[model samples]
Target: MKTLTALFTAAALALGANAAFAKDVQPDEVVKLVNAKTIKSLDELKAAAVAKHPGSTVTDSELEDEYGRYIYKVELRDTQNVEWDVALDAKTGEVLKDERDN
Candidate 1:
């Protein structure tokens, strides 16, 4: 009985953690936010990233809410094959973090 209770508690904790981490922004919601000026367009955000890392190719991107603030995370690869991770403030199109992905 004790083992079963421990298993259930562990499962509950795992599920709760998964739920907290998997809160993804849906496509339509993103569109609505852009329309309402709550966030910058993806194209503009990408442009800002490219401007900072000239000649780099965008590898991956995601829009997420971190610490209750919307942010756009972009990954890039440069001519020298260096990987970069860039985070931008989705609302104001401000670059928050730009660092190598080593």
Candidate 2:
């Protein structure tokens, strides 16, 4: 039983480590995702958001394929301690998921 438990623990750790790397996004697909939405450019999104919400900053973003569509992962926070994790549609500029950060 002790040996079995040790093997199980090792397996779990191995799985956890493998999950750490971020998934790859093909360059062409990424452009299609952004262009289809009429986003034009990443700088445009940043500028618009900053203008709307002063003091808030977008820290990081990534494009991912999910549910047969592209999703943009956006993370931001403001002086008021408001944290935002939003997933926007790559083809439509629609908000797919918006959650308040804990």
**Candidate 1 ranges with C-alpha deviation above 4 Å:** 1-22
lDDT by residue (1-102, candidate 1, tens digit) is 999999999999998886586355788989998999999999999989988889999999988876568888899999999999998998898999999999
Report the lDDT tens digits of candidate 2 across residue range 44-98: 5554444444688898787665545555677878779798777666555666666
- Model 1 gets an lDDT of 0.89
Worst 10 contiguous positions by lDDT, candidate 2 = 44-53
In model 1, the clashing pairs are none
TM-score quality measure for candidate 2: 0.56
As a whole number from 0 to 100, the lDDT of residue 15 in candidate 1 is 82
* Displacement of the residue 82 alpha carbon in candidate 2, Å: 2.4
What residue pairs clash in candidate 2, if any at all? none
